[model samples]
Target: MASYECNRDFPVEIIPSSCARHSIKCRKIIVEKIRRDRISNSIEELRTLLQTNQTNQCPEQPSARLEKADILEMAVQFLREQASSKSNESYQSGFSHCLQETLRHLSLHAPLQPAEREQIKRFYVHQRTSMHTRLSTEPRAQFCMPSKRHSTLRVRKSLWRPW
Candidate 1:
């Protein structure tokens, strides 16, 4: 095999020897070394990858220094954080929703007449207790999960006063 030009896209320069086979052999060895070196073994490589991912789209194919296990671990941690954040958000939303309903009902009634006020208070207290109990007893992983539908109720107000 006669010596030929190497592909312009290759990052490392393979010495253009008289024989193309020798150049190809050298390139293969270089790639092999890169693959054998894990990102965990080199702090610099890990930093560079983290920076690249944070800044922009990485090149079409990154260096083989990034191990499959490292990538999988990162993905798992990200999903865990996402789940925890979602649980907190759902819990807050449910609590706020219960409060909002209670307030809206009371507001519409204006000044409640004692018995009616007591009834509304009891209803709100029951909802609050149920929410608190569920939040406390549920597993951390399952805490504060939203319903499958993920829908919110919209409130429309005050079109009665002639826009």
Candidate 2:
């Protein structure tokens, strides 16, 4: 029986009697090399190429067609909570800005149907009244008082007198 060594590039020193073992090693090496080359290519470049192709594939904005009354109501509730807490001013400003942007987008792209708009208005009114009641009843609720400058503009004299 003539023992055959694997093809010239692989220094596979052991000469196997079966052809199956030799082919498996050769195929594995080829697959591994292809995988390594693929990994070496820049992923960012591939992403950019894909994005470029997709740039012209713009779909209509969801706000253009979908009724977003529920979404708007949720945003209003979130804003009210933030306002009541009186947390970081910058964060509150950013949140409000984003909410406004979303509303603007919805108005431009997906205007709500007349019925949906009415529902949204009703929901907002109900939410406001509920929040007011909760704030008044909750003992731990800390009401955010306006700054002294703002307060002074509304009143002629301090309500509390010095003892």
Number of the top TM-score candidate = 1
How far does residue 93 in candidate 2 sit from its true spot (Å)? Answer: 8.7
lDDT, candidate 2, 27-134, per-residue tens: 898999998777545443444443343233322212222123433333344356456446434544664567557667877999878897777667656755654554
Residue 64's lDDT in candidate 2 = 25
lDDT of 2 at 86: 62
- TM per candidate: 0.35, 0.26
lDDT of each: 0.53, 0.48
Q: Highest lDDT among the candidates is held by which one?
A: 1
Q: Which pairs clash in the backbone of model 1?
A: none
Query: Which lDDT value does model 2 have at 90?
Result: 55
> Which parts of model 1 have CA positions greater than 4 angstroms off?
1-81, 87-91, 94-98, 132-163
